[model samples]
Target: MFLKRIVLSLFCFHVVLGKTPEIREDVRKFPDGFLFGVASASYQVEGAWDEDGKSESIWDHDTHKIPSPIDDMSTGDIADDSYHLYKRDVEMVREMGVDFYRISLSWTRIMPTSFPDKINQAGVDYYNNLINELLKHNIKPMITLFHWDMPQKLQEMGGWTNPNIVDWYGDYVRTAYELFGDRVKYWITINEPTQICLYGYGLNLLAPRLNIPGVADYLCSKNLLLAHARAYHIYDEEFRASQGGNISITLSAQWYEPESELYATASREYLQFDSGVYAHPIFSKEGDWPSIVKEKVARKSAEQGFARSRLPDFTPEEIEYVRGTSDFFGLNHYSSYFVNMDEDTINSYAVPSRADDIGVNVFKLNEWVLSEFSSTDYVPWGFYKLLNYFREEYDNPPIFITENGFGTYYTGLDDDERVTYYRGYIGAVLDAIDDGTNIIGYTAWCLMDNFEWTKGYTVRYGIYHVDFESPNRTRTPRKSAFVYKEIVRTRSLDIGFEPDTSVMTIDEGH
Candidate 1:
């Protein structure tokens, strides 16, 4: 035991001194029964925005009405034409040799009226065909019910901020379960509620740019959580026994590292605000908002002259309904931030803003390596810490890394940086597994390049490159795709493995 402690101390010292840890071949091997898959969202990939009785989503409305809302002045009106090319997408998924494919169902596409009053048969046919194609190739399907593409009709009706959205969303989710739950074993109720509530509602950075900060964003959080719980309960009570499927919500969980030990509490508070707001109600033993979040937001609201806290409170019944709603923890992680406690940070943010309410400043370290085309920095240690944090804080719930990938500019077929990013982050996963994290599966962020929300096509997170300018929107596998394929095929991470990028083809029996 003394010798083991000495070796562990040396390993920690090397890690702190920026020395690379020795990679053992055994460390690279994934546990048997661990799953690998790739992911894509509806608005990001599917075109045919207005075709086949499909109504407009908030993304369609925002991109059409707001000038230069996207970085490339581009709209997802015809992203990748996946509506027409889903078979090719299934082919790509097969080529990657994954266990499943994660895709989202567009709310407006299935229910053009944004309600169960009418179901669009044509939209149902589209997904039916995709799911059938995937199953034909022996690939399981994991479907996300919502991925930040609320129907324009719903937005006009106050969207997620209105308490009535719970029933509306419950009706939509019930219709979806009745339609596709039989084929889909994994169902994600909503993807990245933090991104939906904070970016879209608070910062005006995403669709339906409400920009009401601490007010509208908080309302969206409560209503969205209730809606998610509604969907989970509807499935649990109505569909689970018949379908034998699992349902959960996805949260964007970037690590919040403190700049110094002094600001550790600040960093924890930031994470509580960022992810805990959405995750706590579902995963926490208490089944309510984090105590720190409630206290801080309420105290700030009082000082801001508000009669009540900006953060909404959950009723006792609502709390009970939300607790244990998720079958698994769906996480989408990318990068990390160093947070510091600074009183002056409040002045930089808009008054009563989420940032000001949290009362911390976050920034990336200059020494960290950034992705080629985006602000994401390489910090696999953060990923390792985050998984362990989830295990410790949330009672080690089964975790599926529903989205993890690096974005880059169109740098042709050789994407070495992305390859490195995957290797490092996935290595972190293996480390977490060794330390007893109940991680079940891993998923790449996307299958191919498509419309990347505000970034548009400027940032590509796909293993396969899509030529957005081409009439066919042709997709060609990048070097990272081959590397990822090898990892999937072998169920091990070969840090020194190099693929022959001359030609890409599906492996035998894939």
Candidate 2:
């Protein structure tokens, strides 16, 4: 099934060019106080899987135990060696002139036993050094507590599927706040719960590969939402008064465009299934599962002889607890898909799966422009629509774009495609802002190339290139890096500006 998805993803190359929106000069300038930054996750970049008292994370276990899942049979055992060369990472971001640098804390690294009973001082010191280094360079730190690298011991204890994780996660987050809340001003409780729950638990595409579709995925989602609320409440009650920081959860959202007017409802429901499952609980006024999602899953579960709906329901108290937990909507958007519904599409999934429950087929239109090296389609207008949807649905919450980037096969430094991708997407962001969306920040997906999960090193999404073969894992600035630097430095997206590719250097104060 995983291999089948991979083959389907590769079909994105068959897409034709769509109409690219013209960037008006007036819409190119970003709002004042709007932040610019780059983001990286610990498991993807931090390679000290077991170094300095750090225990194994689920990624460590998965890649080692079943290397076949990774395209290159590679592991993140030494990805970018950021555990040792974090100073160089700081330098790269400084050179880019970003206002902040977002990174995730490794659960296993800080609490090697998967609990707060024994704090790893060496792990704590390593993060302290990174945080201190960023602050010295005037870069604010935006830290995510969990970015899918749960401790293996905790996974052995049933991971997110186990309701006990609500307390387990709450304790872990409290320890993080107590240790680093003094310096870090922006905290993301968890990054992309849908990716963590659905992909990792349902699809078997990622680590921990639970793959118990419909049942396990729904259980994971329920517990994850509670865990997120627990973390938010912990920060609110304990750290917010003293630390003065903002916290939220990031969602991996992709705009789902209906294939036609006939399929509008299908697209809306697909969006609900894709991201609304998580978003509705936290951001909606009612704060339970979406009615359509509940109805659909319940009907299907009854047909399958299950005693209850496959999607776990939030109790009244749980609903209120999760409701309004986020300070801002942390979003990670990459592309868009056209959603369709028909008997054939519904029958294509395993009988008791998420796809079966959603009852929709989502695919990129052949008319959309395709990224040459990745499955992501270029559809900036879709981004514009998604922002509008969020503004209208969630009553105009402040939005922080936590991760957005173009991925590619490791082509050298002259990455024109990525530059174009950024320019188009940022233009869409400006359009959304002009339409009264409360977008406060934008973060490029990463600072440099590192371990890219299941695709392994086969795909790259970094502004700077890392030579994985080199002992230094040498970093070199790509063309997109210079383009991004200009945008950050000037606080404007000059669509026509072409940066000089001759030299890459840190600007004088950076």
Candidate 3:
């Protein structure tokens, strides 16, 4: 009987271990006065969609319709009810002692017709109120001009691909500068241009769904970068003098690794093609398209039968104008990976080069990690390594941690894993700062759970958990809320700050 029990135990262990490598956490250090805050995009958190003369955004239709490609088909129609409960939201910010609040402006809400010919006063007022509230509490606002919510009308007019979009985007950006530039000092010309190009045109996954991956996504990527370049030029030449504001675009990233031992030499070579092409023109020491990206895209275009490379060319003048356009860097990072860029990526996966565009095989560290990021190990040290990469590769520019947070599969107020996540992450930022990375500040990925793009609302990255069941979309402080608030109040990571279960219920109400 004892022998039988031992055999059964061994069988159960093998079954349970079908596939989960023993993951290890690498502890790291962090820097001081490295600002820590939280973030929320307009479309995800602010739910007064179509209210107060606000028209529809590209995402509204995607989340509301049948056969909705969204994982949960859950819309942000009443997300956190932040539009109404902003006061409560601010209180949370205050309690958390956040030094800055990163907020995005919905294009449809600010300019209902998707043009400057008309400004929705109600829409303007709603944003004005939110901004003023942040300033009132001494929280500086980091405003993102666009965050995936394009005006539905823009979709009808051919969004980013149409070359004419250069002028259209310029007009909208100029108007935004004129209207909100004074109050909003930090402006992101665009958010995740890679995703916009890849998902919108290539995958037919995001709104205004189009499935011309090799074709449309690549074309869109070029036009989209030009649009960003033009927008940056407008701000630098026109607005910087008067508006006295700073501008940059945000990129979503995962660390890369080459397939074999020799792959490390060309690791960044792969990154230069994927993200570097998009970023080098704007942020590199000598801003222009990386030679590798230009050569590959051009070669691929010819092979695929195009008049010219799918990538739009920038004149010498255009290159100079775009270089050094940014006053700072905005990075939205989640995880890191080992990248393989050979037939493993192309022939085997058939993933549009838009994804593994590097023309090399990209293999991951593990499979249990989840999402597109499963390729990456959750090494906080990767954050340190990435920061070092930015400093050494691109000229060391001031960077803002536009978004970073740990995601989980459950909902509970007593979230200790989140505490450890912040402990490690925030510490890593400090480590980078100590190493002279010039990281200005860090913002938590979310203030409250809202609509996560492709994954839908299933993922929660909030410090303060939102109750979807509550009619008011009530937000009660999660255990992490108290953990974060105390860190804020003390202005220090409480090495001495051991979280007790009691803090979860004890409200030193703000």
RMSD, each candidate, Å?
4.6, 5.9, 9.8
Give the clashing residue pairs of candidate 1, or none: none
What does candidate 2's lDDT look like per residue over 1-510, in tens digits?
557434423322111122334666652678899999999999999897889999998899988974378999888999999999999999998999899999999989999998999999999999999999999999999999999999998898999999999999999999999999999999999898888888899879888898899998999999999999999999999999999999999999998777765666676778789889999999999899977789999999999999988888888999999999999999999999887776786798997999999889888776665555654577888898888778877899999999999888846898888888899899999988988999999999879888889989998999999999998999999999999999999999888788998987887676
* Candidate 3 residue-wise lDDT, 285-339, digit = tens: 6777887677777787787677887667778887886777677788878776665
Better of 2 and 3 by TM-score: 2
What does the lDDT read for residue 510 in candidate 3? 30
Candidate 1 wrong stretches, greater than 4 Å? 1-27, 370-375, 508-510
Candidate models: Cα lDDT each: 0.88, 0.88, 0.72
Query: Candidate 3: which stretches are off by over 4 Å?
Result: 1-33, 341-345, 349-352, 367-377, 494-496, 501-510
lDDT of 1 by residue, 48-155 (tens): 999999999999998887467888889899999999999899999999999999999999999999999999999999999999999988899999999999999889
Cα-based TM-score, every candidate: 0.94, 0.95, 0.87
Q: Which candidate model has the greater lDDT, 1 or 3?
A: 1
lDDT score of residue 50 within candidate 3: 75
